[model samples]
Target: MRLSGKRASQLALNAFIVLLLAMSIYPMTILLFGFTKDSLTWQYNQWLPALPMWFTNLNYAWKQVGTAFWNTLFVAAAATLGGVFLSSLGGFVFSRMKFYAKEIIFYFIIALMMVPAILGLIPWYLLIKELGLLNSLWALVFTSVFGAPIFGIFLLRGFFSSIPEELFEAAKIDGCGNFKLYYKIAVPVSLSSLATLAIMQVMGVWNDLVGPSIVLTSPDKFVITLALRNFSMSMSGGGMLTNYPALFAAYVISSIPLVLLFFFASKYYIEGLTSSGMKL
Candidate 1:
């Protein structure tokens, strides 16, 4: 039987997609199995972990935890909310309002993105020290929360720019004040951009290791990555305190929220990226 050209193309594309997916998921699969598999006993030839595995590593992680989880949750959530709100509001203003030197100011800020993030570390540390925010979650939140990165603002600006100008005029005519226009009209319709912004900010703030490591000295003040680094490697296994499986288990556990968040927000995330009027 001769296969149609379209069917053959579809089959090839499906195979390509599946292969790409497997490539992407390979690292995560190893970490997932680390939760159940023993690090001590391993066969190199075996791609998958051995059977008869137990949940000992996961149980240990759950019961032997400290403040890393809660601290990460709070910081990530606060930064995400504040960063998203501020960026969206800024986007609305830049897209809808006419002002002097608007493009000049916007381009100036956008140019800051070209500057390497490493260049700001010194200044950020100095600023944090001056404000007495050292050893505090506020240092991390402050970096992301109220003042957002240029890319985030840039992304939301494109989305807001795509919205019809007539909507804003109608809202104003109906007695909608500036804040109300933004909060009630702009925000409600921009859920896609908002979700993308929130997800990005949350992931960035949560997974941040360098900032927290530099600003924070106290063990209890450590976020998830730093805390996991210090604690997970110390778990008992493999005839020593350091257990590879336990560390991977901790990584797996810590990543749950982010995975779920992306799963739920992926629709809106894709929508935001694909929306029209994404020009500068």
Candidate 2:
């Protein structure tokens, strides 16, 4: 059978994509296999998972990583909820309401996004200290809730503005107030966008190391990233690799929250990304 040039090109592109996907997941596959091996087997084999599947490593890793995991989950949840609410409210106001100098105000808010976060690090730390948020998870929550909303607002304003004006007018005619319109119409209509923002915020707070490292001085308050780093370093014991299976298990365990998040929210995440900003 002879293939047409277009068909041949399509097959080649599909094969290339599959190859790239495999390459991307290969390290993760190895990590999964590595976690199932015992220390002695890991030292000898160093590749495939061995027999007797040491589930003890997972138990040990869980004991070490569980507290930090819950702490991180709490932070991510609070930050995402607060940030998304504020961002959506701001977007609705800017898109639907009449206010003085709204454009200028929005542009000013958006302009802050241009200022690099690193430049504000010292000032932020000082403010957190002054507020007595040092050594507290609330510091991270406050920063994330306030600092991360600019981009969310920007993304959501377009979605809100694209909504048809007739819906608002009809709602208003039925005695719907601004807040009611926002809650009933705007929010329901933009679930995918809201989910997208929530996922981004959750992922950001979940993976953040620097903010938690600086604000949280106590081990009890540590997030997963910092905890994982400390765990790995402690396992190394001055750079001599000591418990590969346990460390790999910790890595795998730390990733479960994110995996579950994407698994559940993937439909909305994909829809939000692909959906156009403008509506007729």
Q: Which stretches of candidate 2 lie over 4 Å from their true place?
A: 1-8, 237-241, 275-280
- The lDDT per prediction is 0.80, 0.88
lDDT of 2: 0.88
lDDT of 1 by residue, 104-181 (tens): 988977787778889889899999999999999999988888557477778878778878989889888999887798
Number of clashes in every candidate structure? 0, 0
Where model 1 places Cα greater than 4 Å from the true spot, the runs are 1-13, 38-53, 63-66, 146-149, 232-242, 276-280
State the displacement of the C-alpha of residue 148, model 1, in Å, after optimal TM-score superposition: 1.9
Worst 10 residues of 2 by lDDT: 271-280
- TM-score for each candidate, following the candidate numbering: 0.86, 0.93
TM-score of candidate 1 against the unseen true structure = 0.86
